[model samples]
Target: MTYTSLMFALFCLVLLLVYYVVPKKFQWIVLLIGSVAFYLCSGVKYILYVVITAFTTYITAMLAHKNKREFSEKLPQLKETLSADELHAAVKKNERKSRAFMLCAVAVDLGILIVLKYLDFVLSNINTFLPEGSALPLFSFVLPLGLSFYTFSAVGYVVDVNRGKYEPERNFAKFFLYLTYFPQIIQGPIPRFEQLAPQLFGEHKAEYKNLRNGYQLVLWGLFKKMVIADSVAAIVGAMLKNTSVLSGLELWLGMFVWGIQLYADFSGGIDVSRGVSQMFGITLDINFKRPYFALNLTDYWNRWHISLGNWLKDYFFYPVAFSKGYAKINKYTKKKFGKFFAKTVPVGILSLILFTIIGIWHGANWGEVLFGVFNGVVILISTLCEPLFVKIRKRLHMEERVFFRIFRSVRTFLIITIARVISLPSNIAIAGSMLLTMFGIRSSGTSFFAFTGQMVQAGDLKMYLPALFGCILLFVVSFLEEKGNSVRDMINAKPMFVRVAIASVGTVIIILFGAYGIGYVASNFIYSNY
Candidate 1:
């Protein structure tokens, strides 16, 4: 089911052929069957999890809507004669029901996630506290592919229904399709119900424009993942494995390369997903937008992982900011420390907490928690200092200078690189050690050239040259894309023969030079695990 796999490519080709041949009305049926088949190939046992989640949330959302309707009906009856106590009691009862329903939805989603993803981690910690003779039962469970993604979408759907942002989906099949859409199932830009469901349920006639645009996007994504990210990974893997033997300069270089590798690998997957969805006449949200070009920590967040960042801001940050506790704190700070302090400090503190939760949401490890906190701290510091920095720049008469802007951009990139190191490790101890080693405090001046020489001797150097060329190409293409020149538009502007020639050449290059088949194992998209 992985986008980069041969099997998936074959499956897509077959599906496309069948889809265009079928009547438009029956096309959805074909897609649904294909989705189920895809899930079955992933392993059948996990289908139960998907069914359980979809059904449970679907029913719960309906019930929640019914309850809200019932409460609203009684509100007018009690409006005039009801005392303050009676009104309070009635409101409290309704609130309790709403809270209970929400809790059930959250628990079901989180419980499945915990059992499938973190049960082993939890049990291992508990086993340490038991005696040696203890015979605690241990079992292994295969995590459902895309469980983290679909579950969140499902949960968000139910929550939105309860909040009145969306009406409950009355049709079970439509709801299921929303949760298990094949293209976005494995990795996602995590579609929202309001944004995506309409497209799925509405009329979708295949368009030549969608096909041309989508195919180009898929090719761009392949170039990034197969040609660029994978090659960088080989180099990074060698350096990280022998960190003890690497020079300080080598370590820093590896970290920088790793940042690029991760971005290409992840954003590449997103591009393919978006393209595939587009081919099906659905438009998924954009995920990344030149994050490295950001001029500040705040700007970096806005560009990087755009979907997840916005999701967190909407579902977590906003609620906490407007919560009673936060409101009280804001009021207190305003009265005591002034409006400027209140406006910034409350948001920074709340953002720190939300980011910490975001980190833990990524995994069941302390490393991820630390990573989240590291990012939070950087953003928080930047928020507090931004005003002062702006004042200083204005005072120095450097506010609008190009050089100052370039310096800020470089500074932001470096800060992001350091912050991402903490995010990549498996444990806080390793992350901290890596940071220390990166600073040259643990340096022994050992030669890293010898290791690089060995890599070259082993014929790994050949794999990297194409990737370097690919990276340069990717940069140029991205620059063009930033300027609003889409691949499809570029192609369409050319003569018909020219378009065909370019596509034929691109296909030949991919078949000959792309990393796949024997001797190469295509790695799964990293974000899929989340």
Candidate 2:
């Protein structure tokens, strides 16, 4: 069920009631049932895919754990009996086998995701090269819910287990709950096995603080989605509808709004997930960190999609960057062209790979591919030219400028926004045209004011008022956060009646100004595609 629906509200309410009422020991079972029920509600068809990943990973991890345990048990004996060189060789052999096992399990899990998400995408590209009469029919299935999320999570867990970071969960049912945790299934902070497992299995006594914080978070998230994101979606949709007639200024403005709508929708959803999780005494990772306030692309990435970025850094980037192959390449470069290329080339290459994967992870579309490629290219260029930039910055004394932070943040936004052509539009040609129109290409007689009038709905003001006000409020909250003040903490520090009054107002505002109703559903939440 969708989060905004009446049915989901009732479902959450019912589950919460049962969760706390059950005995402490049985509380986990209640969560398991609730989680399974939630998954089944999403779609029974998805169950098989999840089971395949879960079971395959489960078996692989159990076997790997066993092998590692045995190796640990034999280590002392091996050290005593074998020479140092022989012991080192034996250790390397064991590591090779463990790596192989990890790769095999990861491949199986990734294969499922590829088949369901990208098989048709691959076929479509191939069809273009063939004659029309010989075109292949598509053979892909519908993607399971949170397929990207869970697959990465499963792979991360497998890798960690192979590295002996943590032991695998022995109980399959409980393991399944970890994967299918209802709150995170839609979009996730992508829980790591270690951080989340204890919380999941441990019994938690309900606390007033948990309820208070959760209530505030959920309320704020709902308001972001319903009041700001959905409201702006209408305007952005209208602008997109008449791209042929819209001016360059208008298209760019629309892109700006798209960024806002995207942030609100994505971060809003994560807030709900984290908030709901808090109520259960399970804390998910933070996904966003005032991304727009970031000074540059690298800093921007660190703030946005914090979980996925960290996952890639830990699992993908480190492995590839530090691999023997790249190390050799770096050594050769250092010998040939000195240390700069040796250091920066590998980083540039890895950034391209990571961001491209990120792009493809978003969707199996040309736009997404371009989105990844565009970001990668920018990163590559920026990395290569960082020394030059540093020189220029010093010459201009830019760091000392009062508006330096504003300038850098705005520059970062503009770079990312220009990439939105292929990102949100998905069609390469259309995206190119939009980019053209966004810069200087425009039709005559389509004034920006007229377009704004249309979006604002004939001077009614009600159409844009809530979104404008909501965004102002959102910016204030985000600004405070960027300044190291937690708005939640601020509210919590207030007197009891004051906190209650604030909560009451937040709830009432969401109920009154929110665009959601009995049948309301969101379609433009970008991350949901991933």
Candidate 3:
């Protein structure tokens, strides 16, 4: 269900009442039942897909864990009987078997994701080069909800077990709950098995602080999604639909608005998930960190989708960077060029690969692939030119002034906003043409604000003004947050009456300004599809 829907609100309310009312030990059971029920509501057929993924990974991890236990037990015996070299070989063989088990788990889960989500894209690409009318037909596979997210999480779990980082969970039920935790089963911060499973199974008493902070986060998320994001969605949708007829100024405006809409929708959904989990006295990782305020492309990445970046770094980038092949390349570069070039060049190239994979992780389309490549290329160039940039800064004798920081932040924001076009459109060519159109060409020499005025007129001032106000409020909150101030903490520290007054005002704002109800359809979070 969409997070903004009334059904979802009611569902959370019921879950909360039952959760705290039940015996503390039974809290986990309630969560499991609720998660299964929620997944069932999406589609019975699709539920099987996630179940199979969870089941396969769990069994494989258990087998790997069993082997690890056996090896540990036998190692002492082997030390007494075998020579040092022989013992080493035997241990290596055992480790190889463990890796094979991990690979099996990865293959099954990733294989399912590829077939369901990317088989059509692969077929179409092959069809482009085929003889006329001789192309293979594509499969009409229905993608399971959050297939990539859960698959990656499950794979990470099994890999961790193989690496002996953590033992495979012995209780099947708890493991299933970790895989299918309802709040994160849609878009995710992609929790690690060890980090999240214990919380899911642990017992906790109902706490006032948890409830208060949880609801506050939920309300704040609603304001962002409903008031700020949804308000801009209308204009963005219109501009995209009629790109051919849109003025250059309108096209640029759409891109800017889309950047806002996407951030709000994705981050807002994450906030709701965190809020709900917090009510149960669980905390998820923070996903966004005022990404628009980033001073460079690297900093932007570090802030935006923080969890995903961490996942890719740990699981993908680091592995490739330290792999034998990359090591060889590093040595060659160091010998041929110098130390500085070798140190950064291999990392830059590997980072590019990591980003391309990230892009493909987004969708089955070529546009998404290009989007990933674009980001990878930009980041790679920045890394390669770091020395030159450092020299330039030294020559200019630049100070770390607030105005300079703002300029850097604005520059980074615009770069990301433009890069976002590839992911926003169905076709890459159309997005490219729109970008070109936005540069200088305008229909009938219309001013930029004139097109903006037309959007305001179409939306009516009542709708338009609130959206503008919401953006302003969003900026203020983000600014405070970037400065490490917690508005929630500030509110919580107030007197009971003052806290109630603040809560009441927040409720009133949402009731009056939220873009939902009879005339509006709830939009799914943007990242849910991924």
Candidate 4:
């Protein structure tokens, strides 16, 4: 069921009731049952995919950890009986066994994800070059829900276990719970087993504060998804359809609105996920941190999609950047291109590669590829020019200025909006041409105010009004939070009547202005597909 659906509400209520009523030690079992129930609701046949992932990762991690343990127990004996070289070889042999397990698990998980999610794209591209009637038939495998999120998490766990970050979980049931925890299965913060497992298996009581904060957070997320994102989704769709007739400003405007919808919808879903988990006394990672307030691509990425970015940095980026192969490339760059490129270019190149993976990870499309490349290049150039930008800002005394800070934020947002166009539409070429067309365009001779009026007139203002107003409220709340004010805490500090009144009002507004009441269409959260 959808997060905002009545059925989901009842499901959660029933689970929560049983969750608190059950024995302290058995609470996790209750939660696992709930998770399985949620999984079954999506589709029963897809259960095999999860089973395979859990089995492979669990078996691999257990075996890898077992190898290490066995080696550890034999270490003293080897040291006493063997020569230095022989001892080194013995240790290396054990290490190889563990490494093999880690790689095999990673390959299996990634293989499943690649085949289910991207194999069709590969086959389609291949078919384009084949003899007309001899093209490979597409398998069209359905991706299990949360395949990308869970695979990353599972692989991360296996890699960590192999690296001795923590002991591999011995209990299959507990490890399975970590993977299928219902709240994050849809759109995850990609929990670490070391961090989330104990909390998952730990006993939880029905604390009043958790119940209050959680329910409030859920309501807030619904407000964003329903009132803001869903309301504006229609406008984004209409603008995409009419892009051929639209002026450059109109297309740019649509992209700007899309940036809002993207943030609201994705972050809104994360909020709900974290909120639900919070009620269980489990804290999911904070996935967003006022991303719009970021000053550059680096800062923007650091704030936006914090979980995945951190995951990539920890499990992907650093590993490649710190690899022996990269070290050799660095040495060669230092010799040929001087120290500056050695210091910066390698990282710039690495960042580009990392971000391109991120872009490709979003979807298996040429548009997404271009989107990643565009972002990667921007980051590369931005890194190379950072010193120049600093000099310019310092010379002009602009770095510390309030207006300049606003300018940078706005500039970064425009760049992000431009990148959105490359992927947000069905036709990437048209989108590319649309951006290029902006440079040489004759103005429509319409004032900005007139253009905005046209935007409102393009769709039902009733739909537009809520979205626009909600964005304003969102900005205000975010601004306050950025300034270190907790809006929820502020409300909680008020009298009981005040808190209830606020929650009631927020819930009623969501119901009335949400997709249910408005002409706006309710769709799945955008990131759920990924």
The candidate scoring highest on lDDT is: 4
lDDT of 1 by residue, 160-249 (tens): 888889788898988888888898888777789999988877767778988878887887787788777877776777765666666666
**Model 3, range 1-530, lDDT digits (tens) per residue?**
88888899899899989999999888988999998888888788998988888999999999988987999999999999999999999999998988888899999999999899999999999999999889999998877777888988998999899988988898888888898888888899899888898888898888999999998888888888888888778778777777766677777788888899889888898999999999988889899999999999889999988888998898888777879998899999999999998988888888888888888988889888888888889999998898898888778766466887899899998888777877788898788777767765535255533454444444535666677888898899899989999978888889999999978887777777778645887888888857
lDDT of 2: 0.83
| Cα displacement (Å) at residue 161, model 3 | 0.9
The whole-model lDDT of each prediction reads 0.79, 0.83, 0.85, 0.87
TM-score of candidate 4 versus the correct structure, residues matched by position: 0.96
lDDT tens readout by residue for model 4, 96-209: 999999999999999999999999999999999999899999998877888899899999999999999999888898888899999999888888898899999999989999
Assess candidate 1 and give its TM-score to the true structure.
0.92
lDDT of 4: 0.87
Enumerate residue pairs that collide in model 2. none
By lDDT, the better pick of 3 and 4 is 4
Give the higher-TM-score candidate: 2 or 4: 4
Better of 1 and 4 by TM-score: 4
